[model samples]
Target: MDPGGRVNIFVDTFAWFTDPAHYTGSNAVQVRVFEHLELSALAVLIAAAIALPIGLYLGHTGRLAFIALNVANVGRALPSLALLAFALPIAFSLGLGLGFWPTLISLIPLALPPIMTNAYVGIRGVDRDVIEAARGMGLSEPGILRTVEAPLALPLILSGLRTASVNVVATATLGALVAGGGLGRYIVDGLALQEYDRLFAGALLVATLAILVEVAFGRFEARAVSPGLRSPADAL
Candidate 1:
């Protein structure tokens, strides 16, 4: 588009944001924002629950490492839209209906890979000598994981959550396409109505939210990880 067109779009987006009509009732921007965050948070939490244990077990026991690797690969390969499409039917069969369940279910896969991979890699990558030393000190297997390996691996484990959180937040926009609510409603509706401002505003909102989540996670990682335990890159 021309520069003039771009400028006009920005101006119109500003107008859309300022319009009071967009802030009330069920389709309000705040409501949509809440919906977006709620869906994204639920997806990430669920994914972490399912992936972390398996990754931790595999990483700790040094068995079935292939599962983590394969799961990560498959999750990365699966398209979010395709997963949403695949989930729609399953959701209906289970009487879960539309909006939340289908969208939330689809997003879980998008979050799984990073979390699982990080948890496994983080735990598995812990210095073997440290583990041996813990054992030498008479720590049991569970004690070693809880006290020794997990603490050292916490940064990377948290890194996976960071990645998953951002991914879920951004991709949650797709939920709007499946009769779900979120900032994406603006984009989908805008395109259909030929309202470029709404489309741009929606895109901008999603981007802003994603960036904020990333920054929040970054701060959290800094505080959560011990200065001594942080990787060299992190330390810098």
Candidate 2:
């Protein structure tokens, strides 16, 4: 159509978002937005649960560093779309539920690399002199990890988690392609209907959510990091 036709369509879609009737109810965009938020949150939490400990262990042990780093690198290299495609058949064969589970599986591989790499770096980056001091004081391996290494490494580890969280939040949108419901449904539906306005709105909302989560977690990370690790001036 003409530019005027496109302009009118945009105006109408904008009006829909503002219209109370369209903003409320089971069918509303608002509901779908919340669903997206919930899905992203759950997936990130589960991913963190799996990634953090393994990352920490890999970092502390040093023996597994090569394997962990390689796995993470492979995760980074693999496309989520490809991963999801491979997971779908396995998921079906195992009788695991589709949609969210497969989506979650796809995301875990995507999320792990940053966490593992960061944890390894953070631990390895600790001041060797400090580590030596701790060992000189009779600290066991576990003791050194818990009291010295992990605390020192926390800020960096959190940085990695932050990166993973944001990536998962954005990638979760792909879930809609496989009938995994989220805000992505809006984008997919809008695309199918050739509704550019709705598609842009969905994309905008996803960007906003990602930024919000990153900012919120960043503050939490700053607060949660061990006091000893903070610079002397900043710690005060």
Candidate 3:
């Protein structure tokens, strides 16, 4: 489009963002943003709860590497939209219907692979010297993992979380497909109405959220790493 058209979209987006109807009223942008946040958080938390332990254990032991392999394959093979469609039918059969639960179920898988892979890789990547030193210090396996390895692996773990969280947030836009009502409501409504202004607003909002999520995670990852991992200048 022309520069004028692009500028108009920006203007329209600003209007949508600032409008009281999209903020203070029922089913407004404010409400939708929270809905999106909640849905994304639930998916990420569930995935992390399950995937992190499995990945950490596998990474630490270097066993059942195939599990990560399989998960990666599944993640690669199925797009989130396809997963949501697949789950919708399955959920209906289970009497979960086509709404929040189905959307959550579908989106959880989208969050899993990165989390599991990162946890596994992070743990596995820890220095042999550190592992040996911890072992030599009479640290039990559990003790060593908790006290020595976990802190070191945290950066990568967070990196995985960062990736997963961003992906989940972006994908939650698909929730609108299932009537799951998120920030995506605007997009769907905009498309159905052929309202390019609302379309641009919704797209901008999601993109902004994804970028913010990434930046926040990046900051947390840097700050969260063990001091030992930092260079002298950084630590100082």
TM-score winner among the candidates?
Answer: 1
C-alpha lDDT (0 to 100) for residue 17 of candidate 3: 73
Q: Candidate 3, residues 104-176: lDDT per residue as tens digits?
A: 9998888888999888889899999999999998999988778877888899899999999999999898988
Question: lDDT by residue for model 2 over 1-236, one digit each (tens)?
Answer: 59998888778668756767757776477787787777777766776787777777777777777876887789899999999898788778888767777787788888888887888889888889998999999999889999899889988988888898899889888888888777787788889998777777778778988999899988898788877667899879
Give the Cα lDDT of each candidate: 0.91, 0.82, 0.86
Query: Cα miss at 211, model 3 (Å)?
Result: 1.5
**Local lDDT at 213 for model 2:** 83
The predicted structure with the larger lDDT, 1 or 2, is 1
* Candidate 1 residue-wise lDDT, 37-69, digit = tens: 999999999999998888787889989899667
Model 1 gets an lDDT of 0.91
Root-mean-square deviation of every model: 1.9, 2.5, 1.6
